[model samples]
Target: MIVPSSLFASGTESWRGDGRTDEFDSVATASRALADGGVTAVTGAFGFDPSGTAALIAPERFARGTRSGASRPLPAVVSSALTPSDVHTDRIRRVLAAIDEGVVDKAVLARTLEMTFDGPLDPADVFARFLPGPDAATTTAFAVPLDPAPGRADHWLIGASPELLIAKTGRTVTCHPFAGTTPRGVDAESDRRAVAALRASDKDLREHAFVVEQIVDVLAPLCRELDVPDRPQIESTPAVWHLATPIRGVLTDESITALDLAALTSPTPAVCGTPRAAAARLIDEVEGSRDFYAGAVGWCDAAGDGRWMVSIRCLELDAAGTGVTTWAGGGIVAGSDPAAEVAETEAKFRTVLGALGVDPADLTDRSRPAPAPTST
Candidate 1:
């Protein structure tokens, strides 16, 4: 179930599933469910591949609100072990080769870490470490039930994502897509310099622009009035800083729900790459599969008004929550450096690593210096 920190105190019920809902039919179906005055949680996989899933689930019960604090600190030994493929720079070289061959202008490359903790694991505990009593407002923290069907192991998808895939409230809609990134510094001066470098870097700016342009192009036809900033603003999470642009518009057709917008704009250039189809093919050959890591996760109300965020900075826990797999990736454009990309994935891993009670340095130690910490 997706439990947003702010809504945790509001007695909001939630649900989850490993299935697909018709993007075209979901809004109307959800509107019917909401006619009775209850909200439903919609969880989707990154859905880059044809077999990915999505669902609109009803909450079984919404317990009275309570303030559950962070979980106990896990032992340091319960850290994620890097795999040979986790720091593999060769995959990036291949992606760059595709860029050189003009197969795609930009493609996002990702890596994974496998974590097995001692003793039983709790999804709430992991969530608490990342969210921390609702004070961590920079990012939206969530936990979605992974398997709601009977005869299945209980599972949940949890994460704290900084990007908003789509938001709908009546006729107005908003999207915040992040593209370029840089690691935050340990001090004020260093942090400022990191932000400046991201803004000034031609490569980063170009990457960021591609994402903004992609979102604008898709949304323009559906909106009566659209607004996009000329430049991106800096948005931060405890993990990294992003070059973000906030786009807003009044939907020309109120019939288009948030879910429809998500289907239309997902696997965006920010997460996929320019010329989405070609990038997806390359990602498949290189990264294999991404279950829900880059997918959309959030709740949609009965009225079809809801919020969904890109699935990043997250972990896919086993049904029992014992084994955890998390992903981190970066965009590859012309002039990209393979070694630097490896470092970028390492930096992105820090958010989930810290949440899981593992030291970031331990993971970073295995790779080349992590590119100052940027996120997908």
Candidate 2:
């Protein structure tokens, strides 16, 4: 349960609720209880075996990540080890077919394919290889474990995402945007150039625009005149630099709680897509799934305002605590290159691998090359 803001220390971040909640102590039981009690929404790890208990979850409580935000909504979770046949996968298959039929040129879809090593995965060993050093204040980047359910085994959701999803203080709301991804280079100069390229990229700019626009559109009716900027700026670090945009607005009315706002905006275009209705249809045709991969995966208070990020860089645990899945994808516009898009997925996978301490280089079977570090 969320501790009231009054319980926490006050400051510029006073809007932050008291940081009193603990990591979910019993994932499986809590998940099950939510399921049985008819909880409206639940989200945890991103790699639960869709064929297992995770798939049985109701849409709200058992929602997926990446889809947690608007601009990044991929219909399915993405990973290397997942099997390709399920209801979500089937939906993606339909979406892909439609794209093939001249419906949508670019539909973002993902998978959470998992792998088991001889040992437990560790993020410390690998995160530095990709991300290197502590970069920003209030910035967190790592491979975190997702408890499949309360009391279940730990599952890995990997990635180097360094953006805040949402934060609230009373009636005020704050959001961060992470789009326009670029890979780091072997040399410092080249790395800088890569980041520069991302900042100046038309495709990236458009992708960023789509999300920023959507946020303003969705919140205008509900918020007290948003403070979103006209253009996103280049926010960078050694590993990755994004066109970070911060959105702040006050709740226009008090009838709804924070949870109500989350329901309306948690999966904005920043994590989903532009023209959401059409994008979802295209996803069904091109990618083929709608399990919990790209849905909301954060906690909430009765007031509803809580911090939730796009469920990027995460995994869901499977039954028997062995198998797993994870999701990753990128915005595909008219100029999107299939190969580069594949590379972006590879870059995202490193966050998971680094967290698991699994060497991405160890995999030779993947169709893509070993990923160079990129800002997640």
Candidate 3:
């Protein structure tokens, strides 16, 4: 057997990355292959917009230092840290109030609220909430700066991402599009319809388009040669049908890193919205605080072939390890319903509910979904 450590021979070797953006349809197979191939980890690089580093990370103590994407004899890494921004509670409240007042009909609002644990935070405890069985499908990963440094957070997270971002040798760069989100439906047919509707919906297409364009746009400046699909293809998973696109290019300068490219593609339209700047501004003003929820938090090699998940499916652990603080959001198009948006938020938070070690019945609380309008 090729020992895992022996599989990679690129130690300090020059890299020419070849990347392809796959979708959920390819995730399982691809991940399996990576595992079978003795890849330390197979990651979904764009996870930062939702779960922060919780997907591609394996539970283990990694050797320290930033390994380049093309490094050899190391665990497969996912991303570099994208820290949370200052909380904007006032902005979130304004939008919700606007929605409630009917000044605006629909808007996709998000929050990055922070919660502190008096003691050390253990993500394993946080993960306990979501994975029903010990063997439940879940992954949590982070890069803690070595030593007791009092600077940036030593730890990060990306709870559970369904997407993957990739880059490889040969100067190729790519992203795997994964969307068409739906909850675990009451029945197979219900889930099927959710997937089907998302696939057919124009709004969903618009959302996918936003991400594709941004990926292309983001990678454009960094690449010497580029190739983007004219249209996205349908890719299905157990729970969703993502709009997948293939983006490939050669790096303009090797000095620049894949992490840099991943950084640019983060908060893509899958989690954010079209007209990204406008959407983020609106969200910043409307969604309150995002904390680390939507930030890109993953580890990558020195060459940048790691995965980063959006920190969506996660919860913040309390020091006592008894409870967790969590948040969720939805894509609010002009046609969205207040009640439906509320329901979607509720659905979006399911994974967190599980991570907090709370039963679905346990989350019933007085916090109702507040409205957000376009009046800002």
RMSD of 2: 10.4
lDDT of each residue in 351-375, candidate 2, tens digit only = 6655444565564334433222222
TM-score of 2: 0.65
Per-residue accuracy of model 3 over 1-376 as CA lDDT, tens digit each: 2111101111232111122222111223434434344333333222323323222322122233222321222121111111122222343345556546655433455532233323344443332222222222222332211111112233333244445544455366666754434455678788678767766777666656667777777778888888887777765433334567767788877644444555567677666665665666666556543445555434344343554445455554333432345666666554444555455555665554443333444323234333343432
Give the poorly placed runs of model 3, Cα more than 4 Å off: 1-107, 111-122, 125-158, 165-170, 225-227, 230-242, 368-376
Query: How does each model score on lDDT?
Result: 0.69, 0.49, 0.45
Question: What is the lDDT, from 0 to 100, of the residue 223 in candidate 1?
Answer: 90
Per-residue lDDT, model 1, residue 101, is: 95
On a 0 to 100 scale, what is the lDDT of residue 89 in model 2?
Answer: 43
For model 2, the superposed segments whose C-alpha errors exceed 4 Å read 1-106, 119-134, 137-161, 237-239, 364-376
The candidate scoring highest on lDDT is: 1
lDDT of 3 at 287: 56
Model with the higher TM-score, candidate 1 or 3: 1
Give lDDT tens digits, candidate 1, residues 1-376: 4433222211122233323322211334444445545444443333443234543355543233444557476644354555344335777788889999999999998877776666657777776665633444336666765553222246667777778888899999999999988888889999999888888988889999999998899999989999998999988776678899999999988866676677678888888998988888788777776656787766665566767778888887777556787889999999987777777777788888887767755543244322222212
